[model samples]
Target: MSPNLLLADESTGSKLRRNLLAVAGTLLLMTTYTVLVITQPTDLTGGLGQGVALATFAAYLLSALLLLAAVLRDLPVSTLTLIPVALGLNILLGQFVGSVMVPLYLDSIGTVLVGFLAGRRAGAATGVLGTLIWSLFAPTVLPFAAGAALIGFLAGTAARFGAVRRVYLAPIAGLVSGVLVGTISAPVAAFVFGGTSGVGTGAVVAAFRSMGDSLLSAVTKQALISDPGDKAIVFLIAAMLVYALPSRMYQSYEFVRRYRVLGNLSGERD
Candidate 1:
């Protein structure tokens, strides 16, 4: 009957709702990721040697589980973004390019982004944990993964210090991260799979060769290359979707932050 008692009851209900939503969202992500991994096209490809194929499959499964755990733990956004991007890159490269470039998508960019937002210690820890996990199952990805982690840490640290906000700096960060991801992945592939030269020579050479061939063919065909057009279109559609959506979710996030719901709930429990 007291006002304070009524407030307490309402807070308890809010806490329960938040927890339930979080749990439900995590379960959905886990199920979707699991199905995606199982049905991935690469799993059917016969190019990878049997040993490599099996190892890769297991690694992917574990990575999916790890990503799911990260989501459940409410890991930083940068870290969360890494999962879909990594998976997308993997699928794209595997289907269009080749497995030789698999390591390039080891979630370095996302880690770096997270570090930038959260600070060095958290960023570095995320990188280190990601690297260790990738190494355990895909040792061939170690060099690239390590390079990605380091780049992420540096980028994050620099962002924290306000060095990352400059327009020029952002592209530089992306370039450095991409190069590191590509370079590191190449050597690891050579070492773990054998019969390949280090990343410096082989991977770079292959990339250049591929670029040259594509450019020549495109020129010969008189195809005007508008690289940003497709990307712009995609982004426009995404923006429209976000704009069209109701703002309830955004409002809810603001409400929680404004009210410090998590803090309040914990204090109540204590």
Candidate 2:
């Protein structure tokens, strides 16, 4: 075998190892999070049992599988990374912070990020699959999944037209996608899981009423007081930091290529 072929094999092996390690780390993080969330001490905490927990595990497994498939198929790493991060963070936030404002917002951000990076077809596929997995825990997430797929398709198309690559444009895309997905999800969640009764027909009307009341209350409360907790603020900062790192690394990689940095550093004789 030629030296070039040997180098290619070595690089491929390294990447495979990195990808496998990333997946393993993600699984460990998610599993730890799920156990903590489902075994919380309060009755009102809505802890899922073994069956649901297993399902949640399966969801992450599916997400990993999807990401691995994307890698094998030569999709961009930006697109694939979103799945593991989203799954891990969603569980973490839900466990530590509860499924209140932050978790929902983060979920929106994740979906939008995936949609932005992957383009419409892949984005839609990932969004639908990811959302379906999430639905195992919260069935009301279905509409959000559907809406995300639509938004992703639009965003992907816009990206092709150069409307999504700009930094200024990204937040706009994210906001629009968030609003569309969130609106549909909010109603469905309210309708499906808002009531005190069991998850069925008799609870539907009460669920809707309660959800309307909560929405009104949230608006009023937000207008009156803004009390963001330290934990939430910290988590937000951390998330931003984490998201920015990948882009920065990608830029560094580009710079290295442009300057032939890696080529020159290697001391191999011709």
Candidate 3:
């Protein structure tokens, strides 16, 4: 066997250490940013500022890229290449969805794809890091990175449980993930954007406000209406994509099993 294929190779161990260090550093940087915002709320309270922003642009940009790099560091060469494609798809789709007057976010397709094909760790990394990258230009997404990470983690986990293998259960996974995201996003929307997302849902929030619903209630309602259906579709799409992948692709991924959409269950690949 090639030295590279040996799990105990010293070079591989060193690479793992380096990646772990990077993750630690990234976390520290993000924690520092959070603390600064909390301790000195006025400085970084708002994502964008013309003067004296809470944190420097360099800090935000660096943390995002570093986390992304760390997440992709351990993947096989072929699988690693897909990360960029996924990120691009997500960003473009997310932007389009944001621009349109719709409450649904179809932006998680990339995250879901990677999550199902990889595993929870990689999936969560993709979600959190992808949202961080998006935050560079769209600061609003930063607060929801946690939600993204959770959804990705869950999607990958569902695959391990054979949900994706069964077409009927895939939508259930999506709906479950969406509800989880809504729980996290509600507070973020309420406090960060004050229940307005500049979309069709925003209008619903406005109506709720006029009807004397609390900001939290309005945002939560909007999420209830929009997130489940949108996330169900995202999961369904991801399942379909997984079904289309060749068997070789599954071999490259540690968490993904031999998946055949229509084949009888022969159990997971070793």
Candidate 4:
């Protein structure tokens, strides 16, 4: 949070119209591509195939966008800006993780960031939106939308429990998030992606499989191995960001009022 987190909405009606128009345009584009896919044969690498892929991608991304539009169109303009930045960060960081083949999927950092700063609905929107946006580049990411949403929702729940306010409790939030996300993601990995996490964490699953463990077990073990500590880092980072926010920004949101990091109201800068 920064003092600049919530810029007042001067032209609320105009902003709403713009948002709706964007949604409409995206839907039209998706429908056009979808119809092309239906009328044309699937080409694994041809133009029509690309159109099919584009249509599917657009549809998936559109769902997330519509959800955000429906639930978060009323958010502060600054927050709307923050969301794009967070989504980009999530994708960039996720790519970095994939390149290194790290066991962790810290991509949900953006989702957690939004939830911590703006509460659950904002957080959920960020998670879903970020994941869908990420999928545009890496279709393999399409299956993990639920896991991303899990991180955002749990991060908000943790904040509500005063985890973000107290430094000591922050790691607890991460640990809890890790456990839940890992459990939730394991099945997705096993079924949707065939236990191949498309990251270095696949090495962990392979090792388990070599030991004669089942695919689901291997994936679950892999998640358990990496998710808890990974999510803990994510939570700690979000808490730190909150701590670094300016007083006005920190205190502006109603959901975070229960936390006492700022001590006294008079202590904040005017």
Candidate 5:
């Protein structure tokens, strides 16, 4: 093989290796936290699971760092620049909707957009980073960092499946994604926060709780109701925003080129 071909093969191999390690680390950490959260000791003040929770937090932070480092290795500088902008979009809209006590968490719009444009790693990184930043002010968001990363990962998966090719299909994908996300996040919400994550979501949970639903069941019911519509709206908005941008700008992304993420409007890569 030519030197160029050899180099390309080496680069691809390295990327694959990094991603696999990151995925494994993230999964391990996710499982650890999920298990701990679910089986939290009832006597925290007297220090039953406090040490374990602290250790888990450290492990979680380390895993996040590893994932971020691996995913960022191959991203172009231009794509990296968009992360902050996307994060801003996530925080502003999410915070506003949350502050107003809206049941929908439209926080992942930017995460979904990044995932659709840059592929899964970048998308996951964006979600993770945005969640960490949000946690600075909203401590409650800290535990859901994995959920945000999942949203970004799913957005990229949806784009890979051509969900973005048709405007309507994007929202449909989002709705389906919501079901999976909601189910995964329900355990955390129920056990950790006692089903009181957001004002609107809490109200729904309360309604279910009042109806004699178990804690987990009430939270899961509320998540099923809120997450699907929230994600659908987010997907539709991201799709519109993508199409609204100048084709030249979006077409330049390597992901858009490789995946034909923009469909016929993808244009030719320079």
Candidate 6:
């Protein structure tokens, strides 16, 4: 059990209640937004296009901030400090990779890294917040915040299950995560954006469409083709980064210590 969870004081109960509320609220908001986009794409993009986008941005930001607040209480100050760097890394690499010739999007490396070191809540917060920040330059990404959050959540879950213990396991976990993410995000891309988000992914979708696939079908097929590879690469990179960290540094995280996330690397020197 986590030492933090062992606290029995009234304050701990209060904190727990508030944390649950925050997490629930974040999930509600993100889920509501995703549903709204999937069900009423025209409503969101019709007369109130920019306004709706701004509203979504605000809602997503609030969800992310609430999740971050809950995570802040659980994670150490040192671990919390890495979030901005991670967010920046997501945006920089996401944009750079999206614009390149590669079909993969390597945006969540930092989020996955945090998940490997911290836990799911922190990683999910990082993913949603990073996507929100990235949306500042690209408004189209606003609708996909839920998907981003899922990546981080999955990454943390993967780490908690010892996916990072072996280098090969990371990509395998990512491959599975990619299929799930792709299915979840396909509806949004198809309904809201006509099944194309980037040039490479768009090309894949177009190829699938040319083969007589419906809009959603083409997008799903494209996502399955691209997302698994993208996430596999992302997870492999994240696992490599975690392995590169000095044992002492990563060991400082309570999540790592409690879960033995690194799988008995005590003999390794800092």
Best by lDDT: 5
Please, what is the TM-score per model?
0.34, 0.39, 0.69, 0.67, 0.81, 0.77
Clashes of each: 1, 0, 2, 0, 0, 0
**Model 4: per-residue Cα lDDT over 1-270, one tens digit each:** 675677765587867775675467446534543453345332434675455555544554454455456556666665677789778878777678779976566777777877777776667677877777777777787745556766877887887667776677878889988987777666546544456645577888989989998766788888888889998987887787778888778677655655443344313344
- Candidate 3: where are CA atoms >4 Å away? 1-79, 93-103, 258-270
lDDT, each prediction: 0.39, 0.42, 0.69, 0.68, 0.79, 0.77
Per-residue lDDT of candidate 3, residues 1-270 (tens digit): 798777754487767875775676457555644553354333224454322232333344445445555655565665567667778878887788779866567899888887777776567777777887888988877766766776777887887677777787889999988987775556556655556666677898888879987666777887888888999988988788777777666556656644432234323534
| Predicted structure 4, TM vs. truth | 0.67
- What's the candidate order when arranged by decreasing lDDT? 5, 6, 3, 4, 2, 1
Model 2 ranges off by over 4 Å:
1-82, 93-104, 154-166, 182-243, 246-270
lDDT of 1: 0.39
The deviation in Å at residue 55 for candidate 5 is 7.3
Residue-by-residue lDDT tens digits, candidate 2, 1-270:
668545333367667865775466346435643453445322222543344444444544454444434343444455566556645554565455544544223343344334444555555555566667787987655434544454445445544444433344444544444444433333222222332222333244444446664532232232112112222232233334424654445233322223321233311234
lDDT of the structure predicted as candidate 2: 0.42
TM-score, model 2 to reference: 0.39
Which one wins on TM-score? 5
Residue lDDT tens for model 1, 90-205:
33433443356532222344454344444443444455456556567666554333334444445455554444433344444444444433333332232233323345334444
> Which scores greater on lDDT, model 1 or model 4?
4
List clashing residue pairs in candidate 4: none
Q: Which residue runs does candidate 6 get wrong by more than 4 Å?
A: 1-75, 95-101, 266-270
